[model samples]
Target: MSIEHLRARASICALTLISSLTLASGCSDDGGAEESESTDESGESESTDESESTDESESTDETESTDETDTTDGTEETDTGNLSCEPEGDVTISYSIEVGALDEPPSVDLDLACTLAEIDTDGVTQVLILDCPELENVAVIDIAVSPDMSLPLVGGEAISMRYILEGPWWFNTYLRLDVEGTGHLLTLIDGDSLLPPEEFEFTSPVELTAVYDLCEPVSDGCGQRERLALMTTIAGEEAQIFDANYAEVGGEEGTEIWVGAAGHLHEIECTDTPDEWFQVLIVGPGEG
Candidate 1:
């Protein structure tokens, strides 16, 4: 071939080589840019996932701590017993007595006083106080029939007495009337004198006044029995005789009977049924 033709061919070959190199370089740069973008996207996703996981863990810990605090606070709230009923100040009691079936007005004097002795809450009854003996069982019979005639020993003479206690902080009041000495004769009467001996027998109904700290003594053989009989009334009975322990010997409801202490008839009452009488014993404070 000619020399000019050979030179032109060489030039065309050089230009084609340059063009191919430029295209290969451009394709490599595009691939690198795409890979870098993919790497950045993956790194951002990992960082977001880690942040969410940390927040969840912290939130769970906070919730657990709050729960523990609430439980601890609830355990410190219930400890005081029934001692909340104690009177904040001193209490006083005033009572009057009426002597029934006396020919003339009886001059009866009662110097009653109560002092706080102790606090007892264990047993069938709660809140029991020790009562002073001087203020507990004392029978005062101040009756004057006629200076002219000595009190007669007849069958139809009735003596009735009523007592009352007034106070702002009084809780529960109970009365106990004890009669001693048998030289003069005085017949006992029931709550209401309308019923006959067989119906509402003669049982004296005295108003019970609340005495502060008056707890029944456990040693007094018939004290509990006597208190129960006095609190309960029966119809058509003379006296209520119980054992020294006042545990109830047995009788029908509303029946009048006497409970004796050793040989002393210290309690008298008429009950509708024997069960009622026994119930009082069951609910009374422990004999301390």
Candidate 2:
């Protein structure tokens, strides 16, 4: 072969080698690009997952902190005690009356009134009123007696009496009796007296009860009606009258009594027959 022909063949071979090398370099670059893109995608997915995880953790922490703050704040959890029923301030007996027949047997009636210096939220009271009257010229008969000395009263041989208390709450009523006079008395009827002596905590009616002579009187029966007209203090503060009628009584036939937050007053009319007996009741409060 000629030298020029050999030179041309060598040139062609060189060109072919250069072309193959270039194609290989391009294929390698494409493979590297695909690998880089896959790595980028994986890194992005990992970043997104990490961000979501961090956000969830932060949210949980914030929720826990809020719960702690709420617990630390001052707030009542439960109620502790029961309500009380004792009187909050000073109390007074405002009025009283004596209930019963006059002739056959000297009957008795009692009425009482009270006042409060201040009202309380609970409205509970522990005060109890009692009746203890003096029998100066009083007489007792076995049967019911009328205002007139002539005939016995209507009911059977019973000394019927009743006591009532007026208040916003109707609590059970109770009575204590002390006889400075000359007789022993027994309670005839026993009502619901075993209740708290105080009024209800809310705005309600007060309780009241009247217990008649459960046992016989200390003395058999007196023949005269009790004449009680004296002054006594009640609840250690209020002033009260036993038998004497106040000016408000006026000239009424039956025993007219008025009781209010201020005090109690009695009214008795003078009868033509001096032999008639007068019945009166005095009420007060003490530790019981």
Clashing residue pairs in all predictions, respectively, total: 39, 56
Report how far off residue 207 is in candidate 2 (Å).
24
Which digits, one per residue and each the tens of the lDDT, describe model 2 over residues 143-163? 111111111122122222233
TM-score of candidate 1 versus the correct structure, residues matched by position? 0.15
Candidate 1 structure lDDT: 0.17
Q: How does each model score on TM-score? A: 0.15, 0.14
Best by TM-score: 1
Tens-place lDDT per residue, model 1, 49-147, is 001000000010111111111112101122222222221111111111211122211111222332323222222112212122333222222211111
Q: Over the full model, what C-alpha lDDT does candidate 2 score relative to the true structure?
A: 0.17
What ranges in model 2 sit over 4 Å off?
Answer: 1-229, 238-276, 282-288
